[model samples]
Target: MTDTTTARKPPTSKNSEVHVKKRRLPDETGIFIVLVAVLLVFSILSPNFRTIDNGFTLLVNGTVIGFLALGQTFVLLTGGIDLSTGANIAMSGVLVALVMQAGVPWPAAMLIALIAATSLGVLNGLLIHYVRIPPFIATFSTQGVALAIPLIITGANSIQVRDIGFSWIGQGRIAGVPLPVLLLLVAAVIAGLWLRMTRQGVHVYALGGNKNAARLAGVNIARTTILVYAISGFCGGMGGMIVTSRLMVGFPATGTGNELFYSIAAAVVGGISLFGGVGTVLGAMIGAVLIAAVSNGMNVLSVQSYWQSLVIGVIILVGVSFDTLRRSRAGRPVFAKRPAVDTPSLPPSTTPSKS
Candidate 1:
């Protein structure tokens, strides 16, 4: 009775604690190395490729795809893909131009364009979450609709944009930096902070890592998914507006197939997992720059457009292959053998020899 209230501890020893080594997760380091190598190769191939003017052109062209890739990163983090991003860009640009042409104020037209783009995202989310459609099929179907809307609206022709103020967003430069490139930088910084420092960002990673586990852990899957797609749409819309400003017209076929290819390729080549739960906006931006560099290098070297396309396709394949291999390696056991355990024998029980 005297010791009844005392807690009895179980056996403890130095060997009781077992240390486990975690396998290092794959990251963008390899991609960065590849980017450096590509840069070196290109720089050596053509003197013009290393020129400051060419560098600026690369950045300017990369900005549009960079924004699209940034948005794609959000969707990819949630284990989803948005095939409709290109179409959303086209439709938003067309709508904005039409509204502006109708004598609407630039600010209001911009807002309307953004809303229209985001609305497509909402519709995509609803189809996936509510109707239980697969992400690819859902987005693919909507892609057709998005592409059609612009064609119908503009009768398949480019619409002129007369708004001088709107043009400044894409054309104006500050401190000798292109406005579009500056916008891309700002967007990348904000997106990077949000994804790395916020709770919702953690949820996104968790959801992508294991959707069932995330749901069990109380992550709001529907809301997160919807938000991700909406972000993608917003980015696509911004890209469209920039392009429209640069061209001084809203081309119904502006983005078309190229947008989808560039956005997805940039994200993948930047080390973002096609399976999701991994990647960084900074890597995506670097990937965009790499792509632009390749294109510029090819142009400087007088490579044919078809050859450029082939090279890009090969790059995409190589990046995806690396990603698949990385994932497969992650699934293997990090430590092949378990730590050995030592157990001490109990002292002979003298009382048991009562016989």
Candidate 2:
């Protein structure tokens, strides 16, 4: 009998293999170049911008918001938006403060805060997935819930966190890095791996690329969408806790209107499409870093606080405009490349063709 198995062929063309490899480096390098240019421009503009102290300070101050933006990355990748992140942050802080004040141990208080935040996420997932409410509407409603809970609990006052040990997660630094920054790194790594390597990652991309196609391909669209929003809420809660710790207090009015930037700016700058399906963890981080740099540079230059908002708004508008232009030039879907179509094996000729 003839052997049925055939030898697997290696990629024959070096050019094809090299072309495949070349793609990996460029996605991030473009962003990196832009970041470097921004840094260079600002350093030249302000002597204080290049100082190590200023850099560390920027990292410390923006760490919590940056972490929240990472979660926003996940939701945005799946073509969903989470408007509730700012609210979640406030609510989580309030929940943590209340538990601690109620004589709960610091660890227990922390756990309670996480649970409260995650519960809010779960609720967002339920509304979006089960109720079939649009993501924008669902998250917007949850945003109200997140904001309201904090006000109800704290009554518009800031609650001080007296336990130093409990505050360490937000305030403590190891080996010269801020604890919040470390947490941000950890969150980024975890998110990056999930979005890059796992089956769920592929599913998320597929869902964003084409919901009907994902469903036809047996990807669980509902589950993935729910999970992404849940993650967004979790990040908000964690960010809230960190901010509370850093300030040593949970203020009800904190993070108001800040969610717009955290969710919108980071994602947009990081190359996450407003229409969804294309983004990366590193890109999101870079975007957050860019925003942080701009804000920090403004501070170093002694620009008025009002001007800071206007600058940030202008940056966002420009970023969005760039993305629009890029999309228009391409004039096709961003991730449209695919493997070659397979040809069916020919059946044995029962009768010779009369060519």
**lDDT to native, each model:** 0.82, 0.77
Report the lDDT of model 1 for residue 266.
Answer: 90
Q: What TM-score quantifies how close candidate 1 is to the native fold?
A: 0.83
lDDT of 2 by residue, 201-268 (tens): 87777777777667767787778887887787788878888888878898887778655665578667
Q: Distance (Å) between predicted and true CA of 160, model 2? A: 1.4
Q: Compare the candidates by lDDT and give the number of the best one.
A: 1
Compute the lDDT of residue 4 as modeled in candidate 1.
91
Query: How would you encode candidate 1's per-residue C-alpha lDDT over 223-252 as one tens digit per residue?
Result: 988989889989889988888888889889
Clash pairs, candidate 1, are none
> Which ten-residue region of model 2 has the weakest summed lDDT?
336-345
Error of 1 at 129 (Å): 0.6
The residue-level lDDT of candidate 2 at 186 comes to 87
